[model samples]
Target chain A: MKNKLLFSLITFTTLFIMSCKQDLNDLSNETNNASNVKLVGLGIMEISYDMKTIRDYETDFSILSELDLSSVNPSEEKQHVEMVLLESGQLNLTITELNFDKKINIPHEILPDDSPKIMKTEIIGNTANFYDINGKLLGSENIPIPNHRETVDKIKEIGNKFSAEDINKTIATMQGYQFIDNLEEFIRNAPANGVQVLEQGENYVSLRMSFNKIDPRIQGASVLLIDKSINKMVGTRIYDAQDNLVQSVFFGYNKGDVQSLSAIRIEQQTHLPSGSEVKMISISQIENLKFNLNIK
Target chain B: MKNTIFKLVSFFVLFLFAQNILAQRNVAWVHGLDGDAGSWQHYNAIFDAERNINSLRTSYNTDNGITHASNQVKNSMDTFYGSNANNPLNLGIGHSMGGLMIRDVDRLTPSTNKRFGGYVTVTSPNYGAPIANSLMDGSVQNAAANACNKLNDGPLSEIFSLPYGITANLTTNVLCNKFISNDLVQDMIGTPITNYDLRVGSPTIEALKNHTNNSNIPRISIWAQESSPVHWRMFSSSEFNNDQTLVNYVNDAREIYNVFFMLNTSLAMACGVGGFWFPPCWAASALYTYRATQWYKGRSWIDDSENIWNSLIKTTRSEQQTYWAYIWIPCSYPPSLVEEKNPNPNCGQWEWREFTRWVSVNYPSDGLLPKYTQELQNIPTGNRYYVPGANHLEVRNMSNSTLNGQPNDVTKARFNEIFNRPQGDWFRTN
Candidate 1:
């Protein structure tokens, strides 16, 4: 009877240890699943880059005219920024340095001598803390968190839900563009979303896409020129519904990494009340870009 | 017979020269909002001094729309010059909203029969006054009054509570009450129809913007910056000094309290040295202690009063700075300087700090209309003249002492300069 009792007790102890191990395994699985879900939510984990933006203005009015903003020399600004997306759906942005080429007279009282050299945002707490280069907290402000994740998700959901044919058709109807092909076949065989191929070359393809469908307020369409070898969009021309060219954008790619963007140039025109037009051109150059970085 | 023929020919030539030189240049001086014909009384006198120039001060209901005022100006010009109303020598010189009215008049006048050879705008809200926007919304005045009240009866009252009645009287009677009773602040409280026309982004101003002025017609704009210290007191009377008497009293009381505290300490030291054994010495020590305690409390009151007084001055200065004109631009980061409700977050926010006024761009103003808006669009930069150290009303007819060796009356000088120029047919002989 004593041998039998000892064997039963040993069996019970073994069962209890196995049940605890199963619970541990289940908890581990849950953690992994949660991490995977977060990864899916944030497609790009982190990005750190230094950006230089140059803005130029051109106007039909006389350069000396106060209304002609072009009289002021083009403004160039450089900044280093690092952004990180956490599993909790919070985005953190750290700006190390920002400098302007033009002489800007900022008040010492407003932007004091002890002003932060490095600024960082804690989105979870909705606070932006300013720090010196030595990482000493100079000041803090309670600000509204920018809904970066939600905005990105909404954009992605819209992109995934709509096919190229449906978007193009909707855009065409709104912008008064006509499609020559039958609607059913066009919907079925369209390769790119919201884009219609205008011409195809050996090394390049020209395509037209409507911006009006995406933003109903913007009554314009964009014509894109893609470089086939690099598989990158190189140039774009934006035209109003009246076929007037309103803006143009050009892109340059990194030589080492064909997929990475190096520089972008955008020129935009705005019509003024005095039957004159003001054109603003901006060029942005990117450097030292690190993708999916662990920024803490 | 030959001498008589030569004399006849010379007389005919001389007569034609006189006609060209002495031709009557008719000028219609128009007034601004809530103004009358008398607005141009001093200006007209100066214009009258010029030879062969006819000055007519035009009066109209400025409370009416700009179009109605423009019609009145046109009718006045017609009556003043009669058959020669459409003469190219006719000129319009307008002040404030009068400038906009003249522009409307030009718009209404047919190009073939140009009523004005040229026009001049003096301290005009050509684009529109930001103050008009504030006045219409009743924000600036209300804000000033609210700030004054808060300083008098809010947290400041509690801070000055130790001094009690005197500090209370100083805040309510001298500082805030005087500020609230300021003429400019009182004037800003009334909302009139003209305020709509004078406001920035108003439909009337938009329409004027859409209708560009005829570039062929010569025009000049005169703007000024307020130099007088009195003008800077937008929310307070000129008599409002820094209340030095109260400051002096507080300083004196603090000194007295220090002396008393030292004396009490000495007495306590004496009592500790066996003076406590005598009843008389003990009673004297207790009385001194009570007196020292009272003086110490008084010292605290003095310190609090000083803080409250400094705060009051700071708050008043801040209020004055808000009403002062400044050129603003978009700014990024350093959020303290930015105005409320940032329109463009991508570029930055609107900067409205007082220091920005001096550092960014000093767009000299007439204590009312900025030089930017005073300048009519498409008007040549050469024609715009800035009168430094002159206020809004001063730009009208008041003399600016800083115009070295030139005529002190900036309005008259600018007018003479425009009319006396040889390019236009309205050229004056003297």
Candidate 2:
């Protein structure tokens, strides 16, 4: 009992000293208790396992970035599971080498004829932002086009990796790489240091990109890095057979309240000039989402 | 019968409890230079003389002899300091040189800070060995002491004196020469750093020297002596009447304890700091220093050299008797001095109560110097005292030299004095 009391006193003194030495009390950005408390889920899809504790510290540092080491062990016997959170008012999905393997069940129906259907509905208050399709914002401001240095590099590199053989008779006739230069022009580089920009607000952006034709080989890989803390598309990288990030995308966000809320949606279309007809193929959406809000 | 069974079970439980408490402590022993660690048999004899304290793993940090026997002592200490500090022996018993080694190890390495639970020293000159200078100049026979402090010419002298004689001749010459000639010694030891020099950087020694004698670690110094000069001390002294042998080691301890007692007596500041409290003088520091200089002077060197290197370094080290200048010496002078004292039997020369701070027996007064002579008659500080039948070496290590000398059915009283076997009656003297 005596020892415990003395220990408590000592611990108190140590804690007091530490607090006196540091200045870390940020009160500027406060959130409601419920808003700050993050929620983790796979949206509507329920995973078989829910591990409360993980071995992320044992995570492979082999990669410079912190990759979740939660049983990502390549061993066949152990089930590989990636845990993610679906926060309130938000549903985000990220996949891995497993990206192409699994598809999200789309709730929306598709048209039987594979004809181009253009939908132009601005995101009302803010056009949100046009990302490089890999999910990264093109720029801080939603311009008519993405900041293009990355788009050009990615498009060109992806073009070079395609083999004539992979470019089947079906895809050869399609207009795919024809607009590659135009896509390249969309990826603009970070502004020069001394250049002054008077505005730092959302600029409605519009993007029109489609793979009118794809090589038959189906060999390409890409990854997107999202900055969840600030709700921004930090970067996106694309690699071909050469295994280089031949393409990249960058973007940023600003702090605002729920009143200035936002959202993002993605769509993918792969067009191949298959037989005589454009193959009036009907393909359902590989992903979907649902949200119901009752604001007080 | 049922009660007896209950008692037995209770007894076993108590034994287990005792083991647990004891095991919680990590222990190690240290020794001063010149004393043979190889002489546990001798240590037994000394323990018997002073009252036995079985604690082992003694250390002796300084001295050419330690350097000579570094490999051996290091191995012994490694076995003792423990592979891990977590589990320790709990009790450490060191003699003259072994005691210094313990202090040094504690000073240099993390042997034990708050960890050590207890300490037992049998006649340790924690300040230093008198014959250090002589030992440096090819005089003292303790090879281990010389080897431990390969270079004792100058800064090393601060620890204590360098006593010289025939025994130190060949070894000192060879070791000193080898040390000086070596490029490594010149480079590595360009400067000699003393314990005082270390007091600034190292906290334990600083605490040992500064704070309460000891706060968390409980410690006891069992000072004992044999005034009768050993065969080697007699032959080593150039001044026929001025020699102190291994037996006089008690007096050196007397000085160290005096300081500790003084600082402890000062009161207020020094309490519960290091672990152990100074026995009598609660306020000894305001009153005295924690790790007192103890003795004012150690033995001197008698130069007998014609060669330059021999004359400069070797001769000066051998001939100087540094002990005379010590503050405690003159004040605690002879006949009139003992009477001038507080008359407390426990009071040593420094007015610090002697009670086990230092103790000596059977002075060889006739042929020895006055300091040694006085030590023989110095009232034993510890009320409890024990003696075994043997000479210096034999008394130091209780082991029998010849088969006849070995373990001759020591009386329970004698065994108690020697081992201080906690559970047994061994600690009867304490």
Give all candidates' CA lDDT scores: 0.46, 0.26
- Compared with the true structure, what per-residue lDDT tens digits does model 2 show for residues A1-296? 43343333223222211221122121111222221122223322111111111001121123311111101111101111221211221111111112222221111111111111111111111111122324433221110111112212322332354443433321222112332322123212102211112222232111111111111222333332322222222223333445532332222211232111111111111111111111111111111111111111
Q: Score chain A of model 1 by TM-score against the reference chain A.
A: 0.55
| Candidate 2 error regions (>4 Å) | A1-296, B1-31, B35-37, B41-89, B105-115, B133-216, B227-392, B401-415, B418-430
- In TM-score terms, candidate 2 sits at 0.24
**Against the true structure, what is each candidate's TM-score?**
0.39, 0.24
Off by over 4 Å in 1: A1-296, B1-22, B150-191, B213-215, B228-363, B400-408, B423-430
Two-chain DockQ for each candidate model: 0.01, 0.00
lDDT of 2 by residue, B1-430 (tens): 9999999999999999887544443334444333344545444454434532334444333423333333344456456555533233345455544543444444334544322334454444333322323223333232223322322322121222322332233223433343233221222133223222221223333433332233333344443322222222322222222223321322222222222222211111111110011111111111112111111111101100111112111111111111111001111111111223554453222221111111001122111111121121122244223332222223344333222224432322343443454563212234
Chain A (alone) TM-scores for all candidate structures: 0.55, 0.17
What's the residue-level lDDT of B417 in candidate 2? 48
